[model samples]
Target: MTETDTLRERVAVELTRARERTLTLADAVDDHDLVRQHSPLMSPLVWDVAHVGNQEELWLVRDVGRREPVRADIDTMYDAFQHPRADRPALPLLDPTEARAYIRTVRDKALDVLGAEPLAGRRLTTDGFVFGLIVQHEQQHDETMLATHQLRTGPAVLDAPPPPAPDVPVDDRAEVVVPAGAFTMGTSVEPWALDNERPGHTVDLPAYAIDAVPVTNRRYAEFVADGGYDEPRWWTADGWAHRREAGLTMPMHWHGDGTATRFGRRTDLPPDEPVLHVCWYEAAAFAAWAGRRLPTEAEWEKAARWDPATGRSRRYPWGDDDPTARHANLGQRHLRPARVGAYPLGVSPLGVHQLVGDVWEWTATEFTGYPGFTVFPYREYSEVFFDRGYRVLRGGSFGTDPVACRGTFRNWDWPVRRQIFAGFRTARDVA
Candidate 1:
């Protein structure tokens, strides 16, 4: 294929992949489940299904395609900012069958837009950036829908094969010591990179050591055994208060027994699996108890991407190649985090394994924009969340799709949020 043909085909493939994945999640439930809001935190699944189509039409058909709105009447209903998620279930949303048809119609028009734009020109078509953005956006909502699945009541509606049992045992003492250096952080030329990761800047980080693998179930269980929750010395006053009020003695979805609950059900906690569904506050407390600290966002990035020998960074911990099952547990291929140290092939330049997939690894930094950050397409997508209250979470979870995750891609949430798929590793500054 020619370069132009290659780009066009690439965009088509990504768009198809994204739509298919969205449909997979949307189809898993019956019509009743689709229209019902599973949680106050999430929009109804039907809303997400139609909203995905509406967003594509707004961007591709109206903005890029220069065509009329697909359904102007439903615009306000789908406008996320205009109507909060809690109120969406009450809105006059398209029913499941109608939503299905509506989304497909918009998609057909979006495909037409894709054909007209060679995707090499400037603006939204530049490098097929808008299509890339839409794919990522849909994938993100799918992840959110996955979160809603977790919060919903009843038997597990979604199921996936479990990742392979741990073949590679992690050395508890394994910590990669990164030498102090200035590393290029974030991306500048990555075509689909969001504005938050733009304008690559140099971050001078001091020598520090980060764990080779994420904190394991057995490790976090030990913290719970040590009264990590009851002890105030180990927690910030706010975290301590929150933990007590919420009565969180262990990681969310974890029980006093060996059971580790996930997605509306409970299962035995594999002692070796990377701990999942932990909040930032809980992670920080555990780090305090361990006499270590969570890695700063810069430190985490450096550990995951910096190559001191080359004085540069790689696109992913395992390098520029796109992710695969052997590389990491991504794209909802597995329902749970693989055992820590399992994906040796996904290790970083300094040998940090599981940096890109599994539970999102929390960092010490707040979610803020990089230098020269500019809002694109819409401000609500990212800018609204870049506040002091939200902490940054690096890496992606098993539920995260390739379209929604990259080394530079950033995810954030309130520190108290535990219903989300998140985990963390500890770091210690070199003395």
Candidate 2:
């Protein structure tokens, strides 16, 4: 097939895959739950479902295809910036049944546009970037919905087999030494790289050692037992304030015992699985208690992507190839993180393991644009979030889709927010 035809097919598959995930999550819950706000941090499940379709229609059917607006009256209702997530349920949202139909209609029109619209010419059309943006956006919302499921208090609704055990026994306490050097930090040539990750830049750093795997539940429990939370010295002023206000003694969903809740069911926390639901403040405090610091954003990327032998950065920890089941736990394949060294094949050249998927690892760096950043299509996507209010989290979680997560992919949130599946690994300066 011609490159155009190939691109169109790929886009179609991605759109389908994303929609399937969105629907599956929506179906898992009843209408009452779908329209219900499970957590203040997340929008109602139905709102997320319809919002993805609205975005698809706005970007693809309206902007790219030059078609009349589909459901323009509800545009304000679905406009994320217009209405905060807390107020979405109060709006006249399309019910679950209507939402499914709306997305189906929008996807049909979007696919039609894909078949006819030339894949090249304008910057947005070039490399089918807009379609990619939509796919990523939908996948991100699906993850958000999954987080809502985790937060909802009720009988278990979602289920998935545990992640595969480690291929080879791994030393959970081991660290990988990344030597001081310069490496390309962002993607300029990657066809669908988002604007925030654009304009590849070089970052230099001194030698440091990062955890070989994420800090596991076992290690974190040690911190908790040692009064890591009670001790104010480990926490920064802001973190200490938030910790006290939020009463964050342990990871979210965790109980006083060694068990934690997952998908509305309480189970023994896996000793080796990376700790989840940790906010930036908790991660920073854990690092301080451990006598190590969270890896800077550059440090995380370099450890995950930079290949010292080749003097180049790879698209993922393993290589430029897309992820498969053997790579890392992603795409909601497993609802929770894998054991620390589960994906031996997914390890980076420097032996850093599970960097791409498992948990969104909190970094020491604040969210900001790279050198020579430029807004594309719209500024709301990334630029609006560029202020220093957010902290950067590298690596995508098990809930992340391959389309949305990459070595350079950036995820950020308020430092005090802990509802999402976030975790951390520690790093230290060379002695």
lDDT of 2 at 9: 95
In candidate 1, position 206 carries an lDDT of 80
The residue-by-residue lDDT of candidate 1 on 281-362, one tens digit each, is 9999999999999999998898888876688888988888888889888898888899887888888888888898889999
lDDT of each: 0.87, 0.93
Off by over 4 Å in 2: none
Candidate 2 lDDT, tens digit per residue, 29-76? Answer: 889999999887789999999999999999999999999877888898
lDDT at 35, model 1: 90
The alpha-carbon RMSD values of the candidates against the true structure, listed in the order shown, are 1.4, 0.8
TM-score of 1: 0.97
